[model samples]
Target: MYYAEGTHEPIIAPATFEQAKERLRKIAQQTANRKKPSRSAFSGLIRCGIICGDCGAFFGSKVWNSTSKYRRVIWRCNNKFKGEHKCETPHLYEETIKTRFVGAFNAILADKDSALENCRLMQSTLTDCSGLDAEIKSLLEEIDVVTELTKRCIAENSQTAQNQEEYAARYNGFVERYEKAKTRVEELHSIKNVRQAQADAIGAFMFEVQELDTLSEFDNKLWLTVIDTVTVHADGRMTFKFQGSTVIDA
Candidate 1:
């Protein structure tokens, strides 16, 4: 709660910081203002982000029979019938999506151990920040070297009479070097933070997937935690892409 703006170097680049804020904003949107009851579990949480392959629009749920005993809901591309070219991708029954997701997940279950191992491997590689640490250190040194040289150039210029054009050119060159080094350092920091975020996501995904011993029914929590998106194609092929880059087609 104290105040210290520039007391120390930032742990992440400004871009990465902005990315974190954007992620938080999306999560808030996904979670906030849910006073109205969600007819489908996937509706409010953005838990089921199914996309249309043809039109690249997210699927939205619609009630089939709001009044009858045999009421049901289906999901289709939001712009399926809006544009000049209608989306050939068919609308999906909610139950069908659930069944297919369960079956596709079971496919991963069939290769569970290997898939888990791969997730661990990727997480391990991502969490390895030593290489980035070394690069950052070297880059910091590069910046410091450039800074000292620029300082010396300015000192020499002030003490002696010299050609103004050459002086300006040399000074500009030092400024460019300093700028490039600083930019590269910030970029490396961003990359390092992005890898760290990916590692954390994979870890969370593995935890959620591993907790499920056997999944016979659709699980909302698991769906929210593990799935990145389900792409519904024109031929009725659905691809479930899970976190950690695991894909299963059904």
Candidate 2:
């Protein structure tokens, strides 16, 4: 009979010290293999992009002096570092921007009416493009009619029912007009899509704003995640606009 550790069985037989040690070592190895490392709460929430409004440049961060007394995380403008014009704004301290962004985000999130108003403003701005879509559709219809006329003129010319030179000139004019209308239609369509995307982006940003708890909870990653560009005015006013807003200033 054998007695296991911590068991209430009768100790009719006992293992040698070496045998007990071997059993404990095997148990330890099994436990180690089954255990998993703990994950960080914010492991997946990191932003790697920063856009500048003044110089239209992007900045990235790098950690420096990992073991030094002054361990630093630095953000430098890629343009200035590449011998581009000295950007007027200094290399921003990551902590400063992080603090400001959190505050701004919190303000937006706290006020339900304001967030909805921002969404409405974006929708209104995009509504201006609605007429352009209608215009493009009408132009497409005109092009179709002109194209049919050109085809009819070609057939009439082949049958010799119409003067060849006169039919050819008319067809060339119709082709030219059709091409111009088609180009205009394409341009308007592109503009319409752009406006629609902007509207959608604004709607999405509003939703994100509604989810945030407080300004201080905003992380550096959240700034890059939510904002398109941040403009600092001459009057010390900072405006942060998302992709869809006409103007978002703080």
The candidate that achieves the highest lDDT relative to the unseen native structure: 1
Deviating ranges (above 4 Å) for candidate 2: 1-54, 60-73, 81-85, 124-130, 161-168, 219-225, 232-238, 243-250
TM-score of 1: 0.77
**What is the per-residue lDDT of model 2 for residues 172-209, given as tens digits with 9 covering 90 to 100?**
89888887887787677566666665665666676666
lDDT, each prediction: 0.81, 0.60
Q: Lowest lDDT 10-mer window, candidate 1?
A: 1-10
TM-score on alpha carbons, each prediction: 0.77, 0.62
Say which candidate scores most in TM-score. 1
* Model 1 lDDT on a 0 to 1 scale: 0.81
How badly does each model clash, as a count of residue pairs? 0, 1
